[model samples]
Target: MTPAFSLAGISKRYPDFSLRDVSLTLPEGQVMGLVGVNGAG
Candidate 1:
């Protein structure tokens, strides 16, 4: 089966810091959350 959403070896550069290699998978019909320290965006 395939994942509803998937990521591999992802990275992003930000003004404060950098997001190193990250990966995740979301199955179908599942909720996901993204949070950071101090409610950072």
Candidate 2:
């Protein structure tokens, strides 16, 4: 089965931080979550 959602080559940048070449995929009937601290990002 194909993925419910897909992401590739994702990136984010800040004067003090950066996220590069990030990728993720969520298949059908699946769940995901992402959490971070108050200062994360």
RMSD of each: 2.3, 2.8
Q: After superposition, how far is residue 21 of candidate 2 from its true place, in Å?
A: 0.7
Model 1 TM-score relative to the real fold: 0.66
Residues 1-41 of candidate 2 have per-residue lDDT tens digits of 89999999999999999999999999999987776786453
lDDT of 1 at 37: 82
lDDT of 1 by residue, 1-41 (tens): 67999999999999988988999999999998887787663
Candidate with maximal lDDT: 2
Per-candidate Cα lDDT values, in order, are 0.90, 0.91
Report RMSD for candidate 1: 2.3
